[model samples]
Target: MTSSNFPKAERLLRRPEFLQFNEGASKLHTQYFLVLLKRNEGTGTRVGFTASKKVGNAVVRNSIKRRLREFYRQNKSLFISADINIVAKKGADVLDFHQISTELAAAFGRLRKKYA
Candidate 1:
C-alpha cells in the first residue's frame, strides 16, 4: 500500500520553489482556492500551501493550511509528478474541511485529465 504520510520531500518549502510557479504554471481557480500546477522532472509530486493575510488572522490561516495538507496527504495518489501551490483566497477561511476537499478534488481532477 502507498504510504499516507506527508513527508518533507513532498513539500515545496522554500520561497524560490513557490515563486517558480509565476513563470509558466497552469492555474486552476476554485471558489475558495487558486491552484497553480507545473510539471517537474522529478518522479514525486511536491505541494505547497499559501494563506495570505487577506484570508484571515494567524489562527484562521493555519487552520486552512492544515486542512489543505491533510487533504493532500490522504489523496496523494490523485496527483501527478508536478509542483503544485495551493493559495487560499479571502473567503476560504469560511469553508469546512469537506467543502475544501470537494473543491480541491474537482480542481485536481481537471489537472489529472489535462496531464494524462
Candidate 2:
C-alpha cells in the first residue's frame, strides 16, 4: 500500500524527472534534528527518515521517526507542487517536537524559494 497522504502534482514531480536538490538541498542543524532535502521524481516526493542504533535504543529511533513524519505531514501542503524528501540525521534523536517543526518549516521555506 502507498503511504503518502499528500496529493501529487505533475508539474513538480513528473515534468522534472531528476533529483536536482541533492547538490543544493538545504541542511538544517537543530539541537534535536538534522534535516536533509532532495528533489526527486515519481508521482510525488517520497520521504524516508533514518535513525540508527547509535542514537539510542529502538524506542528512541521510533520516536524520532514519528516526529519526522509529523513534521512532514504538517508542512507537506506548503510544497504541494514539489516532490521533496526530508531525512533525519544522527542529531535528530535528541530533538523535541517543536524544535523539529521549526526546523522543518524553515527548510521548506528555503526549498520553496530555490525551486521557485
Candidate 3:
C-alpha cells in the first residue's frame, strides 16, 4: 500500500512526538483499538502504532502495527490534519484486516465530525 503520492516525510518519528500526542490527545474508540487524534498546526497527516504486551508477544504486536500502518496508509484521507496514534488492544491480535478497517472507519467518521 505504499504510495508515491504519500511520502513518509510527515510521519511521527521521535519518541517525544508520540508522547506529545498521547498526553492529551482526543481519543476515539472501537472494539479493536483506540484512536488518539491530536490536532496540530502541522500540514498533512502523521501516524503511529502501538500494541501492549497484553495484546500479544513481540511478533503479534509487530503484526498489529504493520496492519494498522497499511490501514492508515490506505484510508488516510478520512483523517484530518493532525498527528494520530493507534493503540491496539488484546482483541486486535485476532482481528483480520477487514474487521480492523471496519472499526477504524467508524472511529474515523466520529473523529471527523468531532475535530471538524
Off by over 4 Å in 2: 1-34, 80-85
lDDT of 3 by residue, 1-116 (tens): 44523466667778898899647888877887888888888676888788999999999999999888878778877889998889998778999899889999888988888888
Model 3 regions more than 4 Å off: 1-6
When summed lDDT is taken over every stretch of 10 residues in candidate 3, the lowest stretch is 1-10
Q: List the residue pairs that clash in candidate 1.
A: none
What's the true lDDT of residue 85 in model 1? 96
Cα lDDT tens digits, model 1, 1-116, are 35888889999999999999989999999888999999899758999999999999999999999999999988887888999999999999889999988999988999899999
Would you give me the overall lDDT of model 1? 0.92
Candidate lDDT scores, in order, read 0.92, 0.61, 0.83
Model 1 misplacement above 4 A: none
* Top candidate by lDDT: 1
Collision count of model 3 = 0
The residue-level lDDT of candidate 2 at 19 comes to 49
By lDDT, the better pick of 2 and 3 is 3
lDDT of 2: 0.61
| lDDT (10s digit) by residue, model 2, range 13-116 | 33233345456765655455555555454345555566667778899889988887777666666553433445456667767999888777776676677666
